[model samples]
Target chain A: MTPEQENQIRESFDHQSMMTTFGASLDDLTPGTCRISAPILDGNQQQHGFGHAALTFGLGDTAAGYAAMSVMEPGHEVLTAEIKISLVSPAKGYRLIAEGTVLRAGRRLITVEAKVFAKDAGENRLIAVLLGTMVPVKPKPTAT
Target chain B: MTPEQENQIRESFDHQSMMTTFGASLDDLTPGTCRISAPILDGNQQQHGFGHAALTFGLGDTAAGYAAMSVMEPGHEVLTAEIKISLVSPAKGYRLIAEGTVLRAGRRLITVEAKVFAKDAGENRLIAVLLGTMVPVKPKPTAT
Candidate 1:
């Protein structure tokens, strides 16, 4: 990705308050790919003291969404139309890492997939997988 | 649902710290059904100022999981196996309410669905829909 394109994606991600709430960060960005990571904290745990499914879904969705956004034109943002996730393993770890990849980029719809891994003590275990479609939308005109 | 069943569901929900982090509450519970609500706070917004999709998915998934749990045997809990969510509209409202129902209850897997509504000025608009499967699990033995 170009420097300008990377900067655009970074700026947009920075404006998302939900990421701040989860303490998630954009770890890497390349054309048609993205990676995001978040630490496991007490606040994002389920009743069993494991990372919540919502946390897993959140990071995966955002990572995949940004992967779609990376290929969009300037001023075009992507919104999730639908997403499906499968929790394969219990999320017991110190942190979670999500890797997103774009399968196809079309004019209106983009197909993306994300794999989430639970990282503990230098080991990573696959916990979840996500597939989704995103729609690109141009920014609305501002009132004069 | 019996009083004991209600208590079990409520107690389990109370122990989930992710719900507390989202400022969500369990609104109602009946046999094979559940409802959850959360306000649209600033901390849970996307870059466009609308309620983040993660918040909507979280509420819907939790409500559906609880609905499945309501029908399970005592000392049994439900965990999400797979979930699919469709965001039909932007979440711009005072709060989001998710209503969950069981489509089928089986020995191991329960099929569930949830409809999320955005409440604005006391009017509710459909924002998202979710379908998922939950697996019933017995508590593990505790060490003496």
Candidate 2:
């Protein structure tokens, strides 16, 4: 990634509000890769005694979005244009870990894959796997 | 749509803990078709004074899932394996309306497309468009 791209990625990561909702943050983000974490909340539970699908989805999306952004040009913003998540196991835990890898990066779109896992009860099971497509747009040029 | 599939779609629609969480019903679902509504809620707002992305994505996924389910057999289930939502406008105060259409239905995966809109001040503007892939699974046969 270009130096300008790295700064843009950092700025983008810092401006997100959804992270506050999930208590999630980027642990490590580099060109083509990223790791995200969040703690489950009481509101994340469903009647089936697992984290709601929406919460898991949100975390997975974040990881994929950031990973895609990491690989983009400096001043380009990555927006999720499409994604798929497969739930493999119940999410019953305090913390969720999401790691995303860039599969294909193009001028217009980036494809990212992510896996979400829960750590609790001394067992770590994959909760969800996500496939996301991100669109990249040039940032508005400075007025100066 | 098969009669068995219709019944299964109804069953999926009927199983909801938060009944008020969604607007409309099975009557609104059809293969390559859908209708969805979301009530106005203060908690569903984002910083842009519009509905949260979570709410929009949930409604979009439900519509797509149900639309896919409407084309399957009674004992089968349609699970959302992938989705992509783009935000074009702020959610605003209007009730959200979503329409999901089947793009392709294959033996392994069904692709559905969804559009989200809001009746903003009596005008509907596209907010997000999502493409989803729904996976179908077989159901157990009845006991003899």
Candidate 3:
């Protein structure tokens, strides 16, 4: 993907409401992969000080969406068709990172996988795994 | 489920950070079933004025968790082990509702499903579906 394409994807993340609500941000974007990260905020945690699964899932799914977008053409956007996430371990850390990779990219359909890791004091532990399918679509009229 | 059990789950939802952040509320709780609802807010929508996928997923997953909790013993809580959500249609509405039902309850795991509906002008449309595995866990020390 070109730099313009990458910038386009990043800008869309700005319009994603749940990402902002969870204090999440897009960290990296490559040809067929993306990384989204969020802090373990006091207002976004569950009972055990672990990152709430909802927030974790949001970051992971957004990463998958952007990863799929990275592989598509610039004018086209992507929407999630389906997403599955399994929590392997409790995410208790200062920050969480979701790394998404496109497994297959078809004309209309794309399959992506994201792995979320919890980083505490420079040590990272795998916390969750996500699998999703994204579909390319024309830009919405309201695209900001 | 007993009234005592319902109250316990209700109290727990009060402490769930993400639910509060999303302005979500538990609308109903019964044995093997739950309903969670949230309003469409400007800070939590996607490009088309639809509720962001993450917000919808969070509502669905919380309903699934509470549904499983309702069927379990009083001192036992539930956590999401795995979750899958499929976006069937765009959610353009004033409010979103997720109704969750338990499919099976096992010794250690419970399977549940949630259907998300978007309501506009008193008309409702199915927008998404969620399936989840919830595992029973001991109550946290701070649980009310």
lDDT for each residue of candidate 2 in B1-144, tens digit (9 for 90 to 100) = 877777666655555332233343433766668777776455444433456566677667777777777766556776667676666665665688888888888888898988888877888888888887888876436411
Tens digits of per-residue lDDT for model 1, A17-68: 8888889999999989999999888888888888888889989999999999
The best candidate in terms of lDDT: 1
Better by lDDT, candidate 3 or 1: 1
Selected candidate, larger TM-score, 2 vs 3: 3
Clashing residue pairs, backbone N/CA/C < 3 A, model 2:
A5-A74, A82-B84, A83-B83, A84-B82, B50-B92
Query: In candidate 3, what are the lDDT values of residues A65-93, reduced to their tens digit?
Result: 89999999888988999999999988888
Off by over 4 Å in 1: A142-144
Candidate 3 error regions (>4 Å): A142-144, B140-144
Model 2 segments beyond 4 Å from truth? Answer: A1-11, A140-144, B1-35, B39-53, B66-95, B100-113, B131-144
Candidate 3 lDDT, tens digit per residue, B1-144?
998889889988888887777788899988999999999888778756679887888889989889999999778888899999999998888999999999999989999999999998899999999998999999667743
Candidate 3 lDDT at A87 equals 93
Residue B91 lDDT, candidate 1, scale 0-100:
91
Predicted model with the maximum TM-score: 1
Candidate 2 lDDT by residue in tens digits, A43-141 = 544433456566677778778887898887766677667677777775777788989999999888898999999988887779989887888866556
Candidate 1 is graded, for docking, as: medium
Per-prediction tally of clashes: 0, 5, 0
